[model samples]
Target: MARLEVRQSWLGDVLGLSQSVVSKRLRGLLPFTGPELLLIASAMNISLGELLGGIVNEKNPHPVDGGSSGVAGGRLDLPTSRL
Candidate 1:
């Protein structure tokens, strides 16, 4: 959030959570839910893919492993289900 000058307390307010909860999530003590991620992305004015570091432009389709999975490590890859 340093890049955008977003503070934890402000993010907590945006997500309707406490600063401690946001801190825990930021420190990896707790995981961020899908809805929470969406809210964070919306607040940051970025797409969910970009927030998750999973955006893959067509020009550089094969970045991490010579595939276009979008997700670099293939760890947070979501299933192709329509919303």
Candidate 2:
């Protein structure tokens, strides 16, 4: 979220998420769909490759459609590709 703030000039509220929520998501404990990755990347004004922390081998591992999986606070809807 700091990156988003510094690099993209976006506040947490602008992304419709709290700072803690965004921070939790960045822990990478759960899998993120293409669109979710895209949203985060766009919000941070960075590339997906950078978002994945240079994990090129694991890029595009899953097809993003629609689904909800249990997360910390609640189920998060998997995002589809917006590209």
Candidate 3:
């Protein structure tokens, strides 16, 4: 998602997290909460399932809507996954 955002020139300064924290989280060395997941998804303009990918059972799932695609306040519904 980050890659896609960068490609689209939509990547912005990450809010509420330090560079080290962002690095660790992106490198799979740290865990993120449900709300955090939602924030990340909202920042990247994608669905939580798309962000969580393999952890979510995409074949059988509920759809999410009313999310923001801009760089502002958007509703984020994080998936309940044990990642």
Candidate 4:
């Protein structure tokens, strides 16, 4: 959107999220909620399916965990672990 000259604040307003939250999502620290993604798609004039087609599974958005656990609130444990 930046390349298209879209304002970050406008995008945040459209998604109903704070600018900081949007920045976190852009930095990959947090994932966008389902509704937020849909709003983003609308803002970009694209369908939700096309917006997330290859990035996420359209059939089932919440993918299976496959038994892999992580840190609190779905954030992966990225710090170096002591053996």
Candidate 5:
């Protein structure tokens, strides 16, 4: 059996972006756009949850319709209490 490897260049190809862009995103110089994230999730043959890095929280319900609240895949954790 051969080893399956994932590389930045491969990811770049999957995202239709240059390797430098992928590197920049990896290094936090740029943010991963929503489409890029979806493509990456597809290319890796992984679920969105796995691609999201296990940030699911059953206790905290996220806002719908693109609300700027709740934990965004571990990016943040905001208080859900409406005061």
Candidate 6:
């Protein structure tokens, strides 16, 4: 948010949530729902992967690339098209 100069109140307004709720999620006191994450990512003009960058496995940064219809680590083999 600092990078974007987006205040908590503004983000809360955009997400249709209260500032406290947004704060809790930002502080890790509450988890951001998938929809909320998608909203934030869209608002920020970024991809969902970039929004969830912290969830990546540092040891194996690239995706495992499991066979088609198989799971790669915990992520599915999905396309990178922008939402």
On residues 19-60, what C-alpha lDDT tens digit does candidate 6 reach at each position?
Answer: 887676666555555566678779989886776675545765
Q: What C-alpha lDDT, on a 0 to 100 scale, does residue 52 get in candidate 6?
A: 61
The TM-score of candidate 6 is 0.63
Sorted on TM-score, best first, the list reads 6, 1, 5, 4, 3, 2
- Give the backbone clash total of model 1: 0
lDDT digits (tens) for residues 21-42 of candidate 2:
5445545444444555567667
Q: Residues 14-77, candidate 4: write the lDDT tens digits.
A: 8777878766665558755555665777888877556555444555454224213211233321
Candidate 5 residues lying further than 4 Å off, grouped into runs, are 1-4, 54-83
| Residue 67's lDDT in candidate 6 | 23
What would the per-residue lDDT of candidate 1 be over residues 1-63, giving only the tens digit for each residue?
666777888889998999997777765556666667678789999887676664455654433
Q: Which stretches of candidate 2 lie over 4 Å from their true place?
A: 1-11, 29-33, 58-83
Of candidates 5 and 4, the better by lDDT:
4
Relative to the unseen true structure, what is the Cα RMSD of model 2? 8.8
Give lDDT per model, in order.
0.62, 0.44, 0.47, 0.53, 0.53, 0.59
**What lDDT, from 0 to 1, does candidate 4 have?**
0.53
- Please give the clash total of every predicted structure, in order: 0, 0, 0, 0, 0, 0
Q: Which is superior by lDDT, 1 or 3?
A: 1
Candidate 1 ranges with C-alpha deviation above 4 Å: 54-83
Q: What does candidate 5's lDDT look like per residue over 1-83, in tens digits? A: 01236667777788788988767666555666555666766877876555555444465343222323223431422121321
Query: Where does candidate 4 stray beyond 4 Å?
Result: 57-83
What does the lDDT come to for candidate 2? 0.44
Q: Is candidate 4 or candidate 6 better by lDDT?
A: 6
